[model samples]
Target: MTLKSPISIYDAQGLAFGILMASLGVTFLKAAALVTGQTAGAAVLLSYLLPLDFGVFFVLISLPFFWLSWVRRSASFTLRTITAVVGISVVSPLLGAFIRFETLPPFLAAILAGACSGVGLIALFRHGASAGGLGILALIVEERTGFRTGWFQMCFDAVIFALALLVLPLDGVLYSCIGAMVLNAIIGWNFRVAQAMPAQQVG
Candidate 1:
């Protein structure tokens, strides 16, 4: 597919907003010492297995998926996805650098961060873009199967969480898994509401 730059103000705003939310989600995962699904999840998994920066790892893992979206979807979709991913890649580490909440409880941090991330993700999806990686896959699956996107994401997160147990302590894996579930729940709830609001208004 041919690629082109996004020109509209609405597209730019959507890309910016989506990226901001995704960055917050990544930051929350770091703060809670939790793992997620998609490229970010793979980044966390890689960080445990290798000596690499998670943010760099995130971008690297997302590249293939970005290309896939470019090929399968519109250039506009790819551009927005790339913008969001790059934004998250840059913002995640910066947030990690500037804000380290060591004293906060992991559960609380995970919930707050996951909720913020979910909202950001939904905003991105609603705007016709994605945060990359399994996010694209999740969207495709939801569209095809008519299953809830949140559940699709949760399944992916579970796989990653299981892999995490192989590398991390049992308790850490458990907390990460729980954190992922909470994040998925937040996304699912919001998605359902967004879906329903239109129908209700139409009625």
Candidate 2:
């Protein structure tokens, strides 16, 4: 098969918006003392347990996924994925400075965080990039089996949350479960819509 076209400058620009939205969502999650799944979720867990920065943990966790992207996708794709991961790491921490929440209800934070990050992730996927970790595997599985990437991501998130239940309080894990469902649902719904439509239109 021929190689897919490299992402254009426009799509790269689009990834920035995606990264920003995803970062903002994570910011909310952190503020509410919630943990998610995927690379972002892992970062949240580590940030809670360690003195490390969330962004730093995010980028560090993403490193292993680069090999998967390179082997399954393309060099261009791997590069863009790297950029997206780094962008998220850098922006997530900075977002706290500009946006402060005095008291965000856990349920509200979960839903809103999920929605925002889900939209951001969709944008990254469409542009041939991801936030790394299970996201890379999700894309690969989706491309092969026509499975929903969101479902694959959700499965990964489930495992993370199962572990999270051990580390986080009951309420936090409960809210996280809700947020994970919302996040994956958005991605699954939108991905189905994209598949049903023409590529040009989806873009």
RMSD of each: 4.5, 3.4
| Each model's backbone clash number | 0, 0
Query: TM-score winner among the candidates?
Result: 2
TM-score of each: 0.85, 0.90
Q: Candidate 1's residue-wise lDDT over 46-148, tens digit each?
A: 8767888787888888888877776666676677777788888888788878877748676776676677778788877776677889887776666556677
Q: What is the lDDT of residue 196 in candidate 2?
A: 33
TM-score of 2: 0.90
Candidate 1 Cα deviation (angstroms), residue 42:
1.3
Q: Kindly give the stretch of ten consecutive residues in candidate 2 with the minimal lDDT sum.
A: 194-203
Query: What digit string (tens of lDDT, one per residue) describes model 2 on residues 1-203?
Result: 13446667878777998899899899889999998889889889999999998989988888889887787666666787888999998999899778888789999999999999999988887776788888887877776788888888888888899889888999999999999999999999887533532233211
